[model samples]
Target: MDVRDEAVTIPASEVLLPADLLVPAEPVGAVLFAHGSGSSRHSPRNVAVAHQLNRAGFGTVLVDLLTPAEDEVDAVTAELRFDIGLLADRLAGIVDWLATERPFGTTPVGLFGASTGAAAALVAAARRPDLVQAVVSRGGRPDLAGSALAQVRAATLLLVGGLDEQVITLNEQALDQLTSRAELRVIPGATHLFEEPGTLDQVAEAAADWFHDHLHPQPASA
Candidate 1:
């Protein structure tokens, strides 16, 4: 299993976002990661999940949704991170890039989002139904996606922490609005961050299974 890991810059919404792209030899599919509020491409949690997916034969792209300057401002205002529309636009732009510019263009693409990034992923999936095949959210705020929730055609899995009652309620409410194949699984004894022992590992395993089940490689172009 030879793997290629590289740092890349993705053009999205008129900004260049830094990203880490990891692809194993003959990948089964590709997954793009959308980090949560105030997080970056280096998010340890997302990195852990991406590693799991990579071992499961999925290529992954972990992207920073905000530019460095914007991140600086966001750290102070805490407003840009919550701007769902802005984040979704960037995520959608990344999806478009993966479909057109990447060598794995023919491969199916999935999205893994965390926190508010989940809403952004859902919105991106709705916007690019033809390219995005599946989505998985970890402690995500799907309710933040608004009406875009109904437009998503991708199979979606929402992973919530069983101990995070408020987020669980929010996810349940959002589940009803989903029109595609959607399911919510609560990881018992885990909180919002899934920081409890072995909880994050469960999140990674579940996400790997979800993406594996839903995404498959397509015939490459001649």
Candidate 2:
């Protein structure tokens, strides 16, 4: 089915975050994206994955965790981008908005995060276990979620690049801390950004499969 994509402004805390919402016709579930440091909803890599999710009959919300002003400051100072607590709080607020808002409120929700944003996503999942059903991390820094890692109830998938050894170790350590069902998948020949040809496609496919399995159940035979 064709998906309808729209630009939206979501109020979180005292700031309005810009986002792109894409809802497929008869979507099975919806996924919210928390982009990596220095990136916005316009991130090409995340946008590619969102498009893939949309084609898979899943809705997606690509949101900017930082406001324009904060983004400018973060660009110069590089401060807020690494503030996992603040980022997680904003992500939790967005999840709250999704649970109470129209059209999306009733849909099952998942989270897809990249880099440091992955830590924020995990922390948000820990904070709102009842609202978030599943989570996917791409080339992420899940360890930065700290003690919140053990509290996340959502079924989580950590996708790391095989070539990124240091990050792979960190993800493994974080995986050990997760009490919920979680798995680590490494994409061969891919680095931190998965810039290799066809590597990002692998990440998207894995994430789509994970969300499809966990977010909602398939209908029983008629």
Candidate 3:
């Protein structure tokens, strides 16, 4: 099961975002990851989840959502990361890029988002319903997606930490607005980051299973 790892620059929303892409041989599907606020493509949590997906034969894309200059500004104001519309626009562009790119052009695509990135992922899914097949949110702020929540057509899975009560309530509200196939699963003993022992692994496994179950399987090659 050879996996090709590439350090690439993706053109999204008129910006070039650095990303890490991993494609396993005969991948069943491909998933794009949107990191939370103050996080990059190098986020350890997302990287761990990507590796889990890779082992499950799913290609993964982890791209930085903001440019260097914007990141600098965001670091100071901490506002850009909370700008759901801007993030969604870039995420939607990345989805467009993935749809037309080589190897993944025809692949079933899914999205994995954490924290505020989850809202962007949801908004992007609503904007590109035909291209996106499934979505998973890890301790995310899906409520920030607003009215777009009702427009999402992808199979959505919301994973929240059991101890994160506020987010859980928000997710529940958003869950009711989702018209597509959706489910909410609370990870026991997990907090916002799932930093507890074995908690992150649970997130990884659940995400892999959801993507596997929802993303259309690739045809067997001769």
Candidate 4:
């Protein structure tokens, strides 16, 4: 695909977050992406979604929720990514940093999270309602979010694969705790990873549209 944005790096709480900063030549808004368990800024799936969002004229940030050393340990034991509190706090710090940063300062922030990262993203958005405008989750473990569910004020979309029965049920269980405008979507013929052909792209497109529709300049365009 053709390049449409610049990549940048920033310091998170404990780590230097490597990010793929996608800026639409003529940007509309911005979203930060949180990958699933054991994934990083280099995840092809998240990168795919970022590409779609960039094409839709939205800026995107795909960054590491953990530091390099932490990620190395987490990648093997899958322990670091499970700490929702720590991850969410890191995400919140990143948002604050962006608020003070350049181009990102002018854009509304949204979050796109998958799997366990979805919970972290939700918690982060909940903690900083003044920053995040909207949120989207793909095959997420919202139930893992615990009480953070009720803290989220941003409009949220939870997308699950049709065959991801367990995760779907978990999301349903988690929905009752949410106080925000939230919806659950099931993509047909998809598995946990949504690796069935174009299903992943479908997910990416859906997320981009959701963020675009829900996130906008504050005070509404009246």
Least well predicted 10-residue stretch by lDDT in candidate 4: 1-10
TM-score of candidate 4 versus the correct structure, residues matched by position: 0.93
lDDT of every predicted structure (CA atoms)? 0.92, 0.92, 0.94, 0.86
TM-scores of the candidates in the order shown:
0.96, 0.96, 0.96, 0.93
Give lDDT for model 1: 0.92
How displaced is residue 84 in candidate 3, in Å?
0.6
Q: How many clashes in each structure?
A: 0, 0, 0, 0
Per-residue accuracy of model 4 over 1-222 as CA lDDT, tens digit each: 344566677777767777778776666788888888888888888888888888887888888888888888887898898999888998898898878884654778899999999999999999999989899999999888898899899999999999999999999988888899999999999999988999999998899889878988766445
Model 2, stretches more than 4 Å misplaced? 217-222
Candidate 3 error regions (>4 Å): 217-222
Where model 1 places Cα greater than 4 Å from the true spot, the runs are: 218-222
TM-score ranking, high to low: 1, 3, 2, 4
**What does candidate 3's lDDT look like per residue over 1-222, in tens digits?**
689999999999999999989989788889999999999999999999999899988999999999999999999999999999999999999999987885554679999999999999999999999889899999999999999999999999999999999999999999999999999999999999999999999999999999989999546568
TM-score of 2: 0.96
Per-prediction CA RMSD (Å): 1.5, 2.8, 2.4, 2.3
Q: How would you order the candidates by lDDT, starting with the best? A: 3, 2, 1, 4
Regions of model 4 farther than 4 Å from truth: 1-4, 219-222
